[model samples]
Target: MVQFSFFVLPLCFLFNSRKIDNENIKTLQNDSFMRYINLESLYLEDNKLTTIHPGTFSGLGNVHWLGLMGNRLQTLDGGGICHDAPSIRWLSLGNNKISTIEPHAFDCLSQLSDLNISLNPLQSMDEDVFEGLDRIKSLYVYTIYYTDFSTAMFDNTTNLDHVYFSKFRYCNFALHVRHCEPNSDGISSLEHLLARGVLRVCVWVIAVLTCTGNTCVMIGRSLMKHENKVHSLFIKNLCASDLVMGVYLIIIGTKDVVYRGIYNRHALEWKESFGCQFTGFLAMLSSEVSVLLLTYMSVERFLCVVFPYRDRRPNVRQAAVVLIAIWLTGFFLAFSPLIGHGLGYFDSFYGNNGVCFPLHLHQPYLRGWEYSAFIFLGVNFTSLLIILSAYTGMFISIQRTRRSIASSFTTYVGQATNGWIPDIQRKNLRTTALSGSMYAWIVIFILPINSAINPILYSLTTRTF
Candidate 1:
């Protein structure tokens, strides 16, 4: 693999030739130079030649290599080349003005092994451009500069060894080679150098907010001393979930920054591997449980307000049972990938970042009927609708209850001493209602924000008006 990285530079030929004038070079049009003397290698680099005719080298049957670097040619007709040099093995056309390559241009060159066309302004390379060269082991093509290479682009090549990109200099160029295997260290080092400081700040902010917010919610619930033990229990569980999520965010963010920076100096430890798997499982579990808990909270509120005495609320014990059920369901769902697919460590050219999240919904090894894209869309949409509908009903009921209370207070104002109703338990009712309202709003607000963050990052990085 390492040896192939050095073969990007083409061999040079230094020889004396007749001093050809501009008119002669210009007059050499298409199909005019078919009978040149036997040439093993030809060098026409760093020249002003703008065209190569169909039969320019038709008779050069002995030609083994060709160089056309640093030229003004805009296109290369593969049909033109294949007609002449069927035995050509190596070809270099780097640093040219070529923007396109016609398919079947090199169809006749079955034994061709190396091809370099880097540093060109090509917008696309047709897949069919590589149709017949099964023996070709290396390919060097110009890619969208500064973008990370994705493995998907090179999936078709079964035995490809190396790829090179050309970098221009004052009067020359050099090739930068990349192997096909994932280079986890290089990816980790680059990510650490670029994202460490920002990630640290993000982790700090998340940790402080999560810890403070959850602690406040817990304290508020405890202070209320509500009679409804089920409501209090659910509130405690939600706080715990939020606390776990916050800790997860901090740990993941810190690891991403630290490991990337020290990638080359250290091998990943066993504890780190365990942490990766643990964090992934917990993050997935907590996220799912949070969603289910929100749904349950909405249903509970709907029953408390809309049905009142008609719908008997779950007791403290029953609520505890439900919470346990939710956790178990989340655990099984989140860790299913590990149980079914055999979780193992993976390192790619991008570096040792973390444990893999279950393969994105398309791996053949995954059991059961695959969830299609449409199903995911429908499931999320339905969940959102259910939560929204329940909350809307709860809000309307609260408004009506407040109106009724106001009317009653007005009617009893004259009969009450000092305008106070001693028998009415106003404080307890207000506390219960207010707590439920606050919890509902928090769930509604956080769900949308969490879902939007990933999409926002992708858009900001890849899209521009």
Candidate 2:
């Protein structure tokens, strides 16, 4: 069979380029588009033009706003036909090299409502510079060279309502504050830099080691054979939980190392992003799962030690069900914040550190602290007690049995039939001792090792960097 192929071309829509502001025009006089009578706004900012002809703007009969900001204009001459242009409502001359504006520079801008002449070298403003602007409502004179302007500057226009003088450098001798927000956090950039750098490096190192070591343990367990498959299954489950914790640590470390502090490094929009919240959720989920799994493992080993001959060991299917339950319970614990467990629990910008940390550690967390205390005492503390007491009891029971057997053996040293214990009984005792010791090592070291390194993990998780 032969197949036919057809090609289709997508339709494209075009727009008028003249309607867009042209930033490449260096001189307004040389731009032919200035005569486009339909143009309503002209932006000639960030250019190299040094002079404005009185007739330069006359062709823009319908232009209602003009921007001449960031230009090299040194003076505004009366020859400009800006006075003859149509009703222009706004004009900007900010960030210019202009040092003077002729007496009647804006005498004909009767309809102008907003005037921006900021960042100029005008040492003083004569009332005549704004004589004809009667409808002006907003004036921006920020960062001007004048120490003080004439008091009558606004007397000619009574409609002025908003005047911005932010960073009025000439007014430093007076009691005026120019900028306030950037320094609101109070920590100097140098101090913040040092703090963030040290923290990021530490977190990165911990994350890499934890992730690598736990991954190796998990993979090793998967490939290795176990004499007791049931116990091996539980060990694998525990390692899986640790793997999640390692992944969580890696995410936190990368976020801090790449983003640094939110105060200076990230934009304001970062607070609305999901990066921080997702990292926090993973961290919480992994942490809760690790603890819950450890508790479950301890209980399972405790049962095995306490009931050696009952054949109570769980099968593979039963272990799977139990592991699922453990995971679900961990999910519930980590998701408490979504139900309003504490205010700002999921907000990354709530505290001084600007991170999504536990509410119990932030300010005004009296109730949160109380809740955390209850959980610590009831869950973590109970688990610790069970693990310690169970292992101690197992060892004690073994020691007592050893003593009783030794006494029996001594009493029946010469009796031919009395010294004979079944080979099965000896094997059972040996198996029990080995199993107990294995569990004791895991309970005493494996679980606590993860818990002991928690401070390092949490230090990075709670901080913004």
Candidate 3:
């Protein structure tokens, strides 16, 4: 068969004596390049090509580089493109939809020096994927978070001089390999999860404040008499929710101490452990329940302020039922990823990052992105809208009441200003960095501070402080 008898659409560019460049090429039939025997490099980058039939490059024995980045290829079975390409040194399949690479996929590329499989949504890598590539020096893979490598995945490639991954924990697997892309995962450096002294100090401080402040609020609210005793129960429950967050923070902080300088050695194990997952569950439950409780509190305040004559406050029994339902809903939201979820749940939804929270905004193609999106963009987003609507209505009501009853703006602004002006201002701490290492700090720092502030914000008008 004439190998180039038919040309691939989008006109593949064959470069100076040694290469073929396919610009937006769509497909490559078997034996497509049988005549390109002397070609040294092939660039099919950023193309719409989906599959590269095995034996497609059967006769290209001298080819050195193959660029398959930004394509739709999903899996690599054994010895596909790398077949017959013994001298191939650099091969990139980055930004593809790859999920699986069968054993000995690179079995023939013995002289391959640099292999890039980065940005591929790899599900799992078999221990023998790189079985025969003992001479390879650099591995440009990962930034794909959910994928777990078999402990022996690098047993053959132990001489790796350069390695890159989404987690610093991965370094432990490639032991003798000295140079690793990320020395630290921001919240955690090679030395500690709370890498910065400031972060370490902040963790303990916020945990103490959150636990202490919420405890004080609960005790004070119970001891003092309020017009709405049922409402007081709701406040007590909110404190309990915040207290869980405090406990979660303390656990993280304590582990930061226990594992102090050897975080890298234990990073992977810690994230995969049951203790981490439970704290994650604790965090999700506390976060969702707290959101619901705040929405409830805001809705009640909106009603009382906007319609002074209407009796909308729930009785003790009603409040109890509502609180129970809220906690139950939170449990459902938090535990949904762990129970009866489809195969994706097997990946350990919360276990991807060190903190055990499944917020993978920074990690590429992480498993459970659908569920996380549903929670962040679906449930939590809806809750945010409700809370905003309640607060906005309450603010509008204050304006109207002021117009009618001549109440001054000073009264409300003064309260907010007074609550905010002393000793602290909330920092948004959002990051623009694409690395999961950088973004994990937002979760580690911001959420705990919010928990610490909740009781203080709630008790601003009271003598509890």
Indicate which candidate wins on lDDT. Answer: 3
Q: Write the per-residue lDDT of candidate 1 for residues 134-182, one digit (tens) a residue.
A: 5677777644242223333444444556655421110011112225212
Deviation from native of the Cα of residue 239 in model 1, angstroms: 1.5
lDDT of 3 by residue, 93-173 (tens): 899998888777889788888989889888867778888888889998767774466568888886689988766657767
Worst 10 residues of 2 by lDDT: 1-10
RMSD of each: 16.8, 25.6, 6.8
Model 1, position 57: C-alpha lDDT score:
58
Query: What digit string (tens of lDDT, one per residue) describes model 2 on residues 259-370?
Result: 4443333423332345544554555566556656655655564455556567767888888898889888777766664454235433322111223333222222322444
Error of 3 at 31 (Å): 14
Q: Estimate each model's TM-score.
A: 0.48, 0.43, 0.72
The top-ranked prediction according to TM-score is 3
Candidate 1 vs candidate 2: the lDDT winner is 2
lDDT of 1 at 88: 73
Candidate 3 Cα outliers beyond 4 Å, as residue runs: 1-102, 105-113, 117-125, 142-148, 166-176, 398-438, 462-465
